[model samples]
Target: MRKLIGCGLVVALAGMLACGVGTEDGPGLQLAFARQPLDAPCPELPGEPGSAPVLDAVELTLLRADGTVHFRKRVSPGSDGKVRVGGIAAGEDLTLEVRGLVSGQVAWYGSAAPVNIRQGVDTTVGIFLAAVGDVSCAARPLQAPRAFLAAAGLPGGRVLLAGGVDRLQADGCGPGCDAWQATAAVDMYDPATGIIYPVARLHTPRALASATLMPDGRVLVVGGVRQLGLQAGSGMFLQVAPGDVLASFEVYLPGPDVWIEKTMPQGMVLHSASLLPDGRVLLAGGGTAPDEEHASNFAYLYDPGLGSAGEVVKVTSAMATRRLGHAAVVTAAGKVLLIGGAIYPTAPPLEEFTPSAEGGVFLEKLSSGLPANLMFAGAAIIPLRPDEVFVAGGRVYDGQVLQPPVTGNSRLIRRISSDDAEWQEGPALASPRWLAGMVTAGRELVLAGGFGDEQLTPSREIEVFDPQGELAAAGQTSVERAGHAAVPLVGGQVLLAGGLGPQDVLRSAELFTPAALAGESEQ
Candidate 1:
């Protein structure tokens, strides 16, 4: 086990719930959870004052490292919703999954993997078991309204929100807006404790950048603009300008919470950064000039295993084409699949990239059954199984409008390996969306607001796409949100932070909990 969760009884103090309920004998574990309300002062310094989480019991499951079930039981928690279990086998690497229950349904879930037990020692495991499928507000919003910011989940259930525009300045925003400025400000949110802390600022201001959590636990950031807000030309089109893009990348060290910046040979924006199986980050396919007007076929690899001393390696061969607003994912075969994107006005074909054994050539055009001319740039891809994923929603080319129409179509790609792959049809979305906020909650794919059919307006409809079932309406938010940061709290609960709302940059926030659907197992 790398680290053990600190076990303790989180006693209620001024509405704050404790982690575990009690202690047990002979290599025991004390487990507890924290929950959020529909409306809470999450960032209020003195204390997290809000309504209580509704949990009646906790279902506990203990397993060996090899997937063998060691112990399983459902016990009623104390007033704080905690339970303690003892008599676990000592010296065994184990896994623990805890579920919070309300009215006998699975509402919340969390787990600690590869845990070890020592004789007569107690393990304290604290988890955040947030309510599922509920929309609530988080208090003390981002110091200011932000749009196009990047957020990533930190170790220990915290979230890091970095670099975005604080406001749409006089330069104007989309539609009638001209330009917006980016902020270097950064913050961290701890869902377990319900607190947001002001952290170290970025060395350079950025927006629409890529942030990836490295294997060593530090966050690696790259590619974004500082002062250039995407301008809507002719009052309907939007794209990032080139000169304002940042060429450097930064790393967020956990303990000090400080960002260490490093320079890259070339600058890129609207690119896809994929963390490889070997602890390296492969950046592929983005616009390099004229708001991506001149797309470049460039690729860079960064090995972050060396901590702050890591380096970014440039690739020898260029990509299949210049692609902007693209999406990439590490495939089951370990190849980097650079999916649908636009080479300016043209949507390029799906290209598979292999850095390890491709003879210095990374990009190889692969075939998918998706519409030949469909340009689903910046589409949402959700993992269904280890070898399967579903790609959804992006702007498609249409001659009628300056900007192509937003799509509600989703194509399922089953990639067992490099040679074996196929694209399956619909499970189409109820509403068409581009740049939508998406989250994979166990088997459920929750797609929140984004740019909808009306161009500048945001989509308030929230839909749940289940591959095992059907696409259904979960709920809707009062505010129209898109280009926002969606951070995962304890047990896959999502915290939606600031983003653009029609004509204004918003400071408002929402806490979303997925529905604990029946028959869903531990995530």
Candidate 2:
């Protein structure tokens, strides 16, 4: 393969030739190139390639018998989806190499059959462009058994999975034998290489933490439980002592591969963080302790560029309600929407936070709330639009029930804007889910692996919702999970990692690739 530099096609002709038809002295060879049809299957390659990548440009190089470059030309496809290259020596055995560029990156490449260019004849080559990248699920995780971990998308199409429980000997620890312990292990997964390797470990072990990718490419990991305890009951081990909440947070700098620890105003768990428009992060409502009785009203602001060493500033503007297991998202209008969670009876189910002058912020309860007291619902920002969010299935609290009643089917809501905001109910989920993971994949919202049904069981089913269309079944994970981390990756893929599985915590992971969209033709 020949590598060429510069943005445009670099043309190098050994000698000047007339643009007219072939002559005895200098015969001109014309070559025409066209892409395969969109419905055509991608050609198999050694590595996975993107499916039906739109070819932005093409480069062709002619080589002599001895493998020396004789001529080269880069040309953009014409209206007919073909590129024509002329002025070549005829009646000679020449090797033709072609490369297809998608967004300036070499995505497809192939060599034409050795050709003996005959005088006064045009040669046509049909190049089939194959797709790149993996479109299949990953079989396992990089680390051991883990649950309630966090994942963030990095700049270079890599994913960072960090801090969760790593199960130890299941039966040796007595009644709590099945109980898993938290881990500080961190792993970096490169989709290009299909490798998940260890990075830096957190200063403290954490599970159920929130990892938000900042605009600067660093990840802010905040608030989770540190330890979990269980007791034997009714011939089965049950969680008797919940883990302690963690006030300390950490920052992971991908460039330096380092972890920096910082402290929040108070310990918290089951919280969520949103990346603000100004590059700072809003760490919102979570329980001050592990139990719902200790749910907190406190929220914090983390400025990555503030203080000589940076710091997490506690926001003095307390939320009207205490929230734990809530979901938060930054709207396009530069406002933060705090959604369903455990709140005091008097507290509203929905609220919005607006940043003010002098580095302060304020929260106002949205006039509209969930149809019911929903918590742990999956939330995501729809693509190609700002200030629009889609929130779905969550557990509904019934005062008399010790365990919140999980719904088998739940309503979905769309928030159009913060100013004069109205929560409009959309379609219902295909199945009821809570603690599910949601991410925007292209223009669609993908919900994966959450607790569902009245029994609050883990699920492996994946559902995709098209804003302009209806909710449709997509794919499934290898294992049923709840509280897992799902992150949208480049190239329209989603990475889902550790969460609580049917029988215990899960260390397994999977990747989901939605089917190709219509009108996606190869260039």
State which candidate has the highest TM-score: 1
TM-score of 2: 0.69
Summarize candidate 1's per-residue lDDT along 143-187 as a digit string, tens digits: 667888988887665778899887565655454555878889887
Tens-digit per-residue lDDT, 423-510, candidate 2: 5665666666767888887678888878765454788778887766467777566568876778887545677776777776766555
lDDT of each: 0.64, 0.62
TM-scores of all candidate predictions against the true structure: 0.81, 0.69
By lDDT, who's the top model here?
Answer: 1
lDDT of 2 at 467: 64
| Regions more than 4 Å wrong, model 2 | 1-135, 168-178, 229-243, 288-293, 384-387, 400-409, 412-420, 454-456, 517-519
What C-alpha lDDT does candidate 1 achieve relative to the native structure?
0.64
TM-score (C-alpha, index-matched) for candidate 1: 0.81
